[model samples]
Target: MTDLHFLPGCRIEEITRPDANSLHICAEARRRSGRCPDCGEPSDAVHSRTVRHPADLPCLGREVRLELWLRRLYCRNPACSRRTFVERLPGLIAPRAQRTDRLATAHGRVGVFLGGEAGARMLTQIGMPTSGDTVLRLVRRLPLPRRPAPQVLGVDDWARRKGRTYGTILVDLERHRVVDVLPDRSAATLADWLRGHRGIRTIARDRSTEYARGIGLGAPQAVQVADRWHLLLNLRQMVERWLAGVHGRLRRLPPTVGQPAGPARRTGAFPRSQGERVASADSRERKKALYEEVRRRHAASEPLLTISQRMRLARGTVRKYAQAESFPERAVQAPAHSILDPYLAHLEARLAAGCENARALWRELRDIGFPGTSMQVRRWLGQRRSAPAKTTPRRYREAQPAPVPPDAHAGAPALPSPRQLALYLTRPRDGLTNEERSAIGRLERDPDAAAVAVLVRRFADLVRGSCIGGNAVVRAPIATFKRWLIDAQNSSVSAVATFAAGLQQDAAAVKAALTTPWSSGQTEGQVNKLKLLKRQTFGRAKFDLLRRRVLLAA
Candidate 1:
């Protein structure tokens, strides 16, 4: 048979099968090394020979092990401090390594792609048995490849231990890869990192004062661009606060003198889970006690902070409780997802076909693949059946048309939450549904809300590169944004005024965000990736490993 040349520059001599899944091959190095590693002088004197066993890539579905016969050479140069050195096996394995170069490379790639435990399992499944720790070590030892400096950088902060410690994530926006991760979110750390890497012409970041200060100090020449998504998000939060303050004004208009009062409003009396009911009752009792104590303290003319200290509650909580109002209700928890979610379409089809019996629906669901109980189906059906039914209005006898009652349409849509309202306001008018349009029209009737809506729409037009008038698309200029900011400030809306002030402080960045297209969206995507890596390791991995995985994987 021909010589086995699986490994170049090495001759395979004896092959032994220790087990059905193992192959041990004894081999000797072919080349005679004569170079002294330290002195760089040629030495051919052989000192001794030794056997080094190192794992190699699997061959033909069997684990391959190489028993390499290596030789030690004496350094012939007397002037060199080194006495003896091991013969180097070029392209095969590194000194003191337990695996061949190619095998280590393969394992490193595996670790980078799948991470520790998952990668270990994958290697074992592929006939290469190795520990997770070994895989991670191999990955850690791999050298990082050099990259050219990016001109456009994106900066953001991610929580290391949320609400306690945070780190900065810098990304090359043009290449869409993370550049580096700083240990802390401090301005000094970020500024130091920025000062090290020059040639950054533009930086896209959020409205973080610390990051802004860092950029100003480190790279004053670089143009800063505020992220549009963050700007819109900030605007939404302001709008929500404004809406919360004026929520009472959003109530339905009172009925006219001759108009008949509508039917008593249907309240949700459906049975809730017992555990949830108990929890909610307990929470309500706690809030009531806290509110009573807060009111008692306020009646005695105690300061907010003093009350908070006495009650061991936050000052904000004390303030909220002290305000003259009834106990605030706890937000209702949304119902959890049921097994019926997969069969919702089928159930809807059956319901449209006049199948209203809960038992029948449950039987049909079980006939397919639903593993849920009949009670869930009953609860769902009860909700559907109990919904307020729409009724036609009776014709009025008066000569002039009677004013329509606020609840004239019995199927009037439920009022949406502030978040939903913000969504409707920010989205294009043409894309809105009939109900959403009606909601917007109702909201516009309030002067404050109307002013905020106008500003929001103008901001949306600027961001989306479209003009607001008659679908005549044109990119909104910085001048229009400035004018809008001035309008918001003068509108007497506290939330809008605060937002406008923030924009004015970062006026240049905000202008660049509107006029220029640079954004920190790519950097945010990288932060998401970092979060995934952190989760994969169960958050036990150190920052070094996480940093390596993020950079190498990218």
Candidate 2:
């Protein structure tokens, strides 16, 4: 067959169609006479004729098969011990490798897209033949740059095999990239990583004692900042606990006593409000309906507890509700003006009169027939003391004189009214309810709201805090929240208090989100794209090559 020259010193010769699926090539190597093929010594000795063997090579389509014949030679050196040696091939792939280096590389790249076995199928479809393992091997052989440990570190744990094993991921804060993954989430393992890496000025980590211990042992100098996300989560749990407790305590109170207004009484426990009643009523209704259905069987001589067991409702509740024809109506009313209000004016007067004694106020309020308990008065006094200083009214006149009334003059523009300014400050968002709007107006006038506002103001303070120094702004609020949580007792204020606590602790991380914005949006998008690539590859492609393509594409 005639040879086709592809380039200088390289030719494609004798392209035999092995099958519709594979291409076979028989080509001669570039020949140059210098040393004996049998030995490296400069001896010229020609031995047997060429032989043919199967090999793989890069081709346009299908699978390209290479059939090569090379010469054998004898040593011409008189003193040489060797009789013959086969000629060594150049520009060929590793020994025993089925595919050419180029084809193997292509397979690896496609494998990452196809993933494992899927990639193998894809390569077959493309006419570049390969298997999943071949694609994996190709990926493993590729060189990757050795990265140094990061300066500022972030350590997070993920399930290796959920419920059995876990892995720790270490990220470089400065580079905003993953640096390494640890096999275990133990303190010893984490400490080892910290010890191996140097110059880590800070660590953002969860509230695990193991990590804290590790940081203490390995990178003592590095400031360990509680991750804002975890702090918020912890605060959420605290809120849930308090909310549940509040509901439970209210349950023991008389049904007729409605929710108390003003600072809620600690022991003059109020009845459930409409919102709480609705939830409780719904739960009761669900249970009652189940019990009635089950009780019919019970009435027909079924065991007493059997119906309860079948329905999964408490035996006592089932017995009580089963006798009734239907679910009972919810009895809830608007919370009343708290019994603490009568003492509010007196408490404020005492504060105005320079009395900071909470215990003293409790006694004074108790003597005035305050239906509520001492704990309630004490809490109210505490809130009053912490409230901000009231703002004095400021008078201002417009620079321009008021225009004449529109109907009075020949041509006059109307002047803006003071009510507009009042509305702007006091009004809630347009669609807000009357109660919500009133709350806003109260917040505008009262010092208590201002105190709450101070904590709310911490949100913005944290944003500016980042620019001030080396992440000190975040630490301050986190510390404050910790203090509040430790001392918190009143369940009424606990929800908002915990929310404040969460904000304080997580302020830094959330601000980091606002400023740097490390959202999972892009990562999630890539994961979705990866799913497609895997489907295309048919689950046969290698992971290393898939990873390479994903990273390179990024």
Candidate 3:
């Protein structure tokens, strides 16, 4: 209600509410004697019509705003040779700021946290008028002190657009915050960041050749520990890649179409599914049809190999079919009969001897002429256990399991296998419950599950076989797993074959990691968080802001 208030060194002259939500105030500057801020001259002539500002009280339980207006008079001193100057205002604004001090403070704080565009949106929500660019300017204008280099540093690379532009970020691991961002994840840039730190003793980073070189150059004495999460992630990716290679080979074969479902047979070759078998058959049929045209030419007296070369069919495939009894009479040899035949006898002997032991049988086969390693053997055995057992004799029945039933446990397919369970257990399962795990376990163990049950049992055996400090020895189960993966008929064998090559490539590291407590748990969590952030940002992210948010949030 009152316009003026008395103070020791300053006076507030007037106050008025221009609108219900805003206040308007006018005040006079009453400085006794001071040099002009603009002209730097002592004792201004009456610099006419000046308004002073005091820090305003909080408004609507939110922010404070202030305004100041002042004029400069022409300096009347000829010898001093100075123009008119405005009164100096310290603790309020720099030389030229359009908004009041209070508003700028609000923008700075909000921009730093919610970012420019987001801050603008939030400010509107809170009844303040602001723009995204204004908030961004506030961020740029915020005063920050030059910081010293951190001792324990972490380095990582981020892609602006994957495979296009990449940037490197340095974090003070102790502070758990990003300190700086480099133009690229190159040895030169990273090395420069490290060179700035005189006291750096250790750096934690991923296994990047560039980063390693940079660290070596920047801080030769710093010990680099490969980030454990990255280690696990690289390992997992490597394994997945190996599996994909086998998948490529399998794709070349046609899918098995309308093939009779039965207990899967044991073949030393990689197992293919009914779908895969159908695919393989389709491919062969297509090839066969093409070959028929070539064969017609051959029958018409074109050279045998010449027909094959023209059609692009293997000469061997043409020769075998050409020599067959008849087109309808001749059977296509199973994709991998050679691998299966030698081991089939051993499987029968084990089952007959009441051994019921996959590992023993796998070992027996390995001792004979099995081409695949023990892991391959174990995968094959696991598939056999998980697959549906045949009512027919072991010699002829194929190992295809029944379809999954409805009303199965939540987050589990109707026909879940132990291999799937093992896969799920390795990663986070947000939707799966304990009941789901048990249900899957039950499915894996069910006699109806066949080779799938074998898979579950093999997983259990591997878990049990984990030992302390000795050789981390490969037990009979591993050999069985390998055998199952190479087997053609076992349903679970497909998954095993896919995972085998990767496991073999880094078999040593993987075995050690599995045997030890190290895992990809943290890395997977980070990947999930990254996906969420990527979705939230929606491709409009600035590298600086994204990097800041990740480092700070972590």
Per-candidate TM vs. native? 0.77, 0.48, 0.50
Kindly list the per-residue Cα lDDT of model 2 for residues 13-44, writing each as its tens digit: 67778688777777665544325444467533
Error of 3 at 223 (Å): 0.5
Index of the highest-TM-score prediction? 1
Task: Compose the digit string of candidate 3's lDDT tens values, residues 1-554.
Answer: 33222222234566666666656555454566547554466675665765544344345543334445555655655655566666655544445665556567777677666766777898766645579888767666666545667777767766666768877766666555456667688998888877777798766666576787888898888766555455434434433332222322222222222333333354223555678768866886876676467557767888868877887877755654454323321121223344555566567667655654455666777778777655555555554553433334775356554332222334222332222333433344455555445433443343433353354344434433443343344555445545643451344444444444544543433344334332333333444454454445565767655554444334
* Ranking of all predicted structures according to lDDT, beginning with the best and ending with the worst: 1, 3, 2
Q: Compute the lDDT of residue 464 as modeled in candidate 1.
A: 69
Worst 10 residues of 1 by lDDT: 396-405
lDDT of 2 at 327: 40
Q: In angstroms, how far off is 247's CA in candidate 2?
A: 3.6
Please write out the lDDT profile of model 1 over residues 1-554, one tens digit for every residue. 11433777777878888999978999887775657889988777889988999998887788888899877889988899999987887798888999999899899989987888999999998878899999999999888867899899999999888878888899998888888888788889988888998999999999999999999999899999899888878877777656644644553422123223333323223455557767867987988888898999999999999999978998757865765345544322223445666777787788788777888899999999889899878866755643322331344222232222233324444345556778888888999866567667777777878888998888776766621333232344777887888898887777788888888999988877776667888898999998888788887888898888888877
The predicted structure with the larger TM-score, 1 or 3, is: 1
RMSD list, candidates in order: 8.9, 22.0, 17.9
